[model samples]
Target: MTLDLPLIWAGLIAFAVLAYVVLDGFDLGVGILFPLIRGEPHRDEAMNSVAPVWDGNETWLVLGGGGLLAVFPLAYAIIMSALYVPIIVMLLALVFRGVAFEFRWKTQRGKFLWDWSFAAGSTLAAFAQGVALGALVQGIPVANRAYAGGWWDWLTPFSILTGFALVIGYALLGATWLIWKTEGHVQRRAYDIAFWVAPATLLLIGVVSLWTPFLSGPYMARWFAWPQVLLVAVVPLAVLGAGFLLIRGLTERREIAPFLASLLLFVLCFIGLGISFFPHLVPNSVTIWEAAAPDNSLSFLLVGGVVLIPIILAYTAYAYWVFRGKVNAAGGYH
Candidate 1:
C-alpha cells in the first residue's frame, strides 16, 4: 500500500494527543482530587505520586501542538481560530496549576488558596481541552476552510457534556494513581472515588456515543459500518472489563494491577475515539490532506520527530524508572 503523508501526520498527531491524555491526565486528576481530602501527609503522598513525571507528561502536549503547526498548518490555524478563547483559558489554567504546584509547598498561610488554584486550574484545563475536542467532533462552523461563527459557538451543551466527562475521566485516573502510590487510608479513599467515578465516566462515554451519531451523520455511518462496528464494539467491552477488573483488583488489594487496568481503559476509550474520527482532523469541515502542509514541510517534521520523539520517550522512561515504588507519608517533595 502507498503511504499517505496526510494519514501519517494524522496518526502522529493522534499519538501525541493520546500520550498527553494518558501521561498528563493522571497528574491533572491528582490536582482535582487534592482538595477533596484533608491533611498534609495525604496531600504530600498525592503530590509525590505525580511529582517525578508531571512535567514530562506535558511534553506530549507541546509535541502534539507543534506537530499540528508544522505538518498541518491549515488545521492548526482554523482550530486555533475557532478555539481561541478556550485555548487561552486552557493555557492560563496550565500556568496557574504549574505555579501553584510549586508555590503551595513553600507558603503556609495562603496554602489553601494555592491548593484551590491548583484544583481549579486542572479542572479548567481538562474541561477546556474536552470542550475543544467536542466542538471539533461536532464540527466548527466553517466555510471555505475558514471558521465562520460567533465566539460562543464553541460553548454548546455538547461541549459542556464533554467537559464534565473529561473531569470525571481525569478523576478516575487520579483515583487509580492514588491506589498505586498510597497506602492505608489514602488508598481506600482513592478506591472509593474510583468506584463511584468509574461508573459515571462509563455513563458519560455512553452518552457521548449516543449523541455523537446524531451530532455527525458521517460519524454515525463510519461507526455503524461492518468491520469498523466490530472494532468499535470491542472498545466499550474492553473498557467495561478493565473497569470491572479495576474494582475487583482494588477490592482484593491487588495493588499495582488496578492502576494499570484503569490506564488501559483510558487508552481503549481514546483509541475508540481516534478510530471514529480518523482522516478528518476538523470533523466534516476539513479532510486531513486538505488541512496538511506541503510534503516538504511534513518531511521536515518527520526528521525532527526522529530525533525528538526518542529523547522524549527516553526521558519519560527514565523519570518513571527513577521514581518507581510506592510513596509513603514520610516521602514528601523536596
Candidate 2:
C-alpha cells in the first residue's frame, strides 16, 4: 500500500493538539477559577482534583510540537516564527503554573503568593493559546517558506476576542470538572459558575463562529460554499447539541455527564476546525504536501511514531482510571 505519509502525520499532529487542548484545558480551567473559589480549602480541593494528571496532560503539547517540527519542518518554521511571542509567553506561564502547583503547599506564609501565581500563569497561558489560534485563523503571512509578518501580526482584534472566549470556555470546563470530582460546597459553587458560564461560552462561540467565516477567504468558502457547505454545516448543530447535553447534565446534577458533555462540545469544535482546514497546515499559506519533510525522514519518524503514540494513549487512559473519583482538600498534593 502506498502510504500517504504526509496526511498521516498531519492527522497525528492534529490529534495531539486536540488531546492537549481537551486534557490540559480543564486543569488550566481549574487554575483560572482558583481566584474566585474563596478560601484555601476549596482551592486546595480543586488543585487536588487535577494534581495527579496535569503534568501528564501537557505531554500532548510536546507531541504536537515535535511532530510538526519532524513531519513538516517548513510549516513548523513559518508558524513558530509567526507565533514566537505568544508561544514563549505561553511556555513561561506554564512553567510558572507548574512551579506554583508544586510549591504552594510547602510554605504556609507564601501559599497565597503561589496561588496567585498559579491563577495568573494559567490565565496568561490560556489567553496566549487562544491568541495563537486566532493568529492561525487570521492567516500568517508566509513567503518563500518563511514568516513574512511583524512581531505583532498575531495580535489582532479577532485574536483578543478569541482569547477572552477561551478563558470563559476553560472556566466552564473547570467548573464542570469540579462537579465531576468534588462534593458539597465546592461542587455546588462549580455548578453555579457553570450555569452562567455555559450560556456565555455558547454566546462567544456564536460570535466567533459568525465572525470567523468573514475573516479568511478559505474559511468563507469552506463554511459557505456548496458541497463543502453541506458537509461542514453540521458543526454548529453538533455544538448546539453538545451544549444542550452539557446544560441538561448540569441541571440534572449527574457527575460524569456534564464533564463528558463539555468534552464532546470541545471535540465537536475541534472536528469542525479540522474540517474547515483539512489539507492546509497554515491555511492560505501551506499545504501538508507542500510542507512535509522528505519521505525517507518521515518514514524513519513513522517507525517511532507508530510505536510511541499507542503507548502514550495507554498510559493516559490508565492515569485517568487510577485517579478517577471524588477529591477533597485533604486528598490534595502535599
Candidate 3:
C-alpha cells in the first residue's frame, strides 16, 4: 500500500505542536505565577523546578515550525502572514524568559527585574499563543492563496477569551508542577494557587469549548453534527472527568496524579482541536495534500526525520530521566 506522505507529515506536525504545548506550557505557567511566590529562595526554587528541562522543551516548537515550513509551505506562508504580530511577540517573550532564566542567578539587586521579566514574558507568550490559536480556529481569510484579512483581525473577543484561557491553563499546569516538585511554603502556595486556579482554568476551558462551535459551521458540525457528535461530544464530558481527577488528586495530596490529570485535560482539548481541523492544514482553507511539499521532498525529509526525531526523543528522555524527582533548594541542577 502506498503511504500518504501528506497525511503522515500532518500527524507528525500535530504531534510536535502538542508536545511543545504540553511540555513548555507548565514552565511558562511557573513564570506566570512568579508574583505570587514570595522570597528570593522560593522564587529560585520555582525557577529551578523547570530549569533542567525548560530549554529542551522548546525543541518541539522548532521541529513543528521547521516541519511546517518544509512540508506545508503554503499553510505556513498563509498562517504566518496572518499571525505575524502575535507570533513575533511570542518569540520575543520567550527570549526574555530565557534571559531571565540565566541572568536571575547571576545578579544581586537587579535580580528582581529578571524575576518580573520572567513572569511577564511567560504570561505574554502564553497569551499570545492562545490568541494565535483562537485566530486560527476562528479562521483566516484567504483569497487567491494569499491572506485576505486585516492586520487586526486576530484581535477579537473570542481570541481575547482564548488568550485568558491559556494563561490560566498554563498557570494551573505550573501550580500542579510545583505541587509535584517542591516542598514547604512554595509547595503550599502552589497547592493554594492550584486550588483556585484549577476551577478557574476549567471554567475558562468550558467557555472556550462552548464558544468554539459557533465560530464556524464546519467546526459546529464537526463536534455537534449528528452521529459524529456522539464521538466528538464526549470530549467535554471527558474534560469534566479529567477535572475530577485533578481535584481528586489535589484533595488526596497525591504528588504525580494531579499533574498527570492536568496534562490529560490538555491532551483531550488538543485532540478535539485536531479533530476539528482534520484534513485542513489551514482550517477550512488549505487541504493537507494541497499544501504539502512534493513526495520526493517529503521522502527526503522523512528519512532525516526518522533519524533526527528519535535522537531528539532519546536526548529529551535522557535529560528528564537524569534530572528526575523533586527539585528542592539544595538539590536539582542549576
Candidate closest to the true structure, highest lDDT: 3
TM-score of each predicted structure versus truth? 0.95, 0.98, 0.98
- Determine which window of 10 residues in candidate 1 has minimal summed lDDT: 325-334
- Candidate 1 segments whose C-alpha is farther than 4 A from its true place: 226-228, 330-334
Which regions of candidate 3 are displaced past 4 Å?
331-334
Off by over 4 Å in 2: 332-334
lDDT of every model, 2 decimals? 0.85, 0.91, 0.93
Alpha carbon lDDT at 147, candidate 1:
80
Ranking by lDDT: 3, 2, 1
Q: Distance from true position, residue 174, model 1, in Å? A: 0.4
Task: Estimate the lDDT of model 3.
Answer: 0.93
Every model's Cα RMSD, please?
1.9, 1.5, 1.2
| 1 or 3, greater by lDDT | 3
Worst 10-residue lDDT window, candidate 3 = 325-334
Greater-TM-score candidate between 1 and 3: 3
Q: Write the per-residue lDDT of candidate 2 for residues 1-334, one digit (tens) a residue.
A: 9999999999999999999999999999999999889988988899999998999999999999999999999999999999999999999999999999999989999999999999999999999999999888878898888999998999999999999998888998899999989998899999999999889988998998899888888888888888778777788998999999998998898888988988888898788777667689998879999999999999999999999999999999999888888988998422
